[model samples]
Target: MTHATHTPRPTAETWALIRDDYRSGITAPVLAERYGVPERTLRRRAALEGWRRADAPTPSLATPPAWLRPPVSREEALARDPDLAEVDAAEGGDRIGLLFDPDPRHLRLFAFRQASEAAAMDRPVQAVSWMRLAQIVDRCGDRIEADGRPLREVDHLRAAYLRRLGELLPEDMPADDA
Candidate 1:
């Protein structure tokens, strides 16, 4: 006996389902499992619709919870965790860089420790700016530039990540990776 193959036809509802799920920041794998489809199929559908998630903010960022708001200062942040203050103290005016990986339901908050002088110069330290430092580290290693001139800014044990990034990054990294 011979078996006949039939092509699967997609409906408008299918596209809407995919678009809605993606817009809501549902991962392709999660959506595939929910809809009983393969992950590759979901990805293909997303690509076909020109629904690129490269710049879309995760749901957590798009709708942040009250507690996830950015802390105003390093002191306010360290207050919640005394150990952080201790580490800061131990560093003795040197900078510290931290990379956080939060749960899917939450946003990952990156932070950097700056010397009081450095903090005063650039108030309102931003987490995005900190990550930019990481990118610079990855791209240029420990050495960087200052005021359009080359310099070394790595040595996390001694320098603030932002100061390094500011000295290195050509201009400025985007605030929203979203």
Candidate 2:
């Protein structure tokens, strides 16, 4: 005759502690091991109780930055800026140019913003690609703006890149203000 081992269900206080730890960004597996519960059990209980990680961005915070937001439709863009209607008609009414022109400075700024967003979302590869694009645009812009043409300082871009680098590789890069 073999005796089966039995584990007691977690008490209310124990469950509360588990929930708190989970919400505080502790992984379910780690919490399970620490609290003497099965990983699946902890995850299931947290799901049933609608537990949200504290580090997760809220809905408003998750919204893309204004510069990254594209116009929903050509009609909407035209409606907002009636002046663009002429340009739209000239471009066959299909391509409604919203915001930035074909300027290298604008392109660089756009790329930098995209890189920043990718970094914020923990997408290191994408962030790096955008950063590279930004660098290329900046270099091209420099050549285009040769002969003492006035251009905005790129210190902000450098600062942003450093911040993103820190986000991607915390140990290698120093932290800076966003």
Candidate 3:
């Protein structure tokens, strides 16, 4: 069996009305009455145009949405929850590796540490290090280029990472990697 799809072609005026009255809580029946068109047709056209009722009450800026609200301080949170305080107190033993947070500073630190460890293990850190440092360079590129030239800022960061690489790796590491 072949199924045929019929798409309703709305006129300019109807489109303008659709755009204008979209979130105005005007039902299809009301729109049909006002536009002298069938309620089903208006609904079909609205569906085709991907219009939705914007009836949800917008939260006031004076009182932010819960997620956007500032979180209480770590100490305050811990004070309220004793179990959390216990966890904070017991933060160190076997969970050392578990605490490897991937935040920007930690990410770079991790790369540096990995480079150092890889060199100790007699494995080159080149393949992974370049990609990781490139990500950092790209993320901070906008801020780094404030003094005019872009390549200079990237080169400076590259030089710093390269210096760390030199410090960690054997002196025989290829110079062209710079």
Candidate 4:
């Protein structure tokens, strides 16, 4: 007859270490090393416990941190600043993504909506949205300008949606040579 011995589950202290380290944005292997737990075991425990990143709060939650929540409707957005709303809506319909998307076109579209929503809150500027737009422009400005398609009534206005921030800066325009 062979005798069998069972391995004990991780201690609560270990589980707490795993959860806290994971919440602090530590990698599983690094967390495992720091906490003296096996990486696979820590990962399995994390998954079993339903641990998730809290980098951004969800919008559906009530009063979800004013900075974290943008206005939910176009009417609400437009009521704050008619110009941005008009220029922004010209790009497309109202839609707020639940996450940061990398596609330039999507980012550009999201920039307009985010800025408009933020403006509706009566801020001098929507810093993050402008930063995102700048990033999109830096990433794909040449492509957008050369693609030679329009997203608004006037070809130039297609991208001039950004000009709402300024009183018609020349940089917000496409070349007239088109």
TM-score of 2: 0.31
Where is model 4 more than 4 Å wrong at Cα?
1-9, 55-178
The global C-alpha lDDT for each of the candidates, from Candidate 1 onward, is 0.55, 0.76, 0.63, 0.64
Cα lDDT tens digits, model 3, 1-178, are: 9996664566897768865685577877877777666778778777677666778455456986444455567688787887886666544422454343223444455456556644554455453674577567557755654545424567878989999977898877666754
- lDDT by residue (82-133, candidate 1, tens digit) is 7787777755433222222212111112223332334444443444465555
Clashing pairs in 1: 55-178, 144-151
Q: What is the alpha-carbon lDDT of model 4 when measured against the actual structure? A: 0.64
* TM-score, candidate number 4: 0.26
RMSD of each: 18.6, 22.0, 17.8, 16.6
Candidate ranking under lDDT, highest first, comes to 2, 4, 3, 1
For candidate 1, the 10 contiguous residues with the lowest summed lDDT are 101-110
Q: How much RMSD separates candidate 2 from the native structure? A: 22.0
TM-score for each model: 0.25, 0.31, 0.25, 0.26
Cα distance off (Å), candidate 3, residue 18: 3.1
How many backbone clashes are present in model 4? 0
Question: Between the candidate structures 1 and 2, which one is better when assessed by TM-score?
Answer: 2
Sort all candidates by TM-score, best to worst: 2, 4, 1, 3
Per-structure clash totals for the candidates? 2, 0, 0, 0
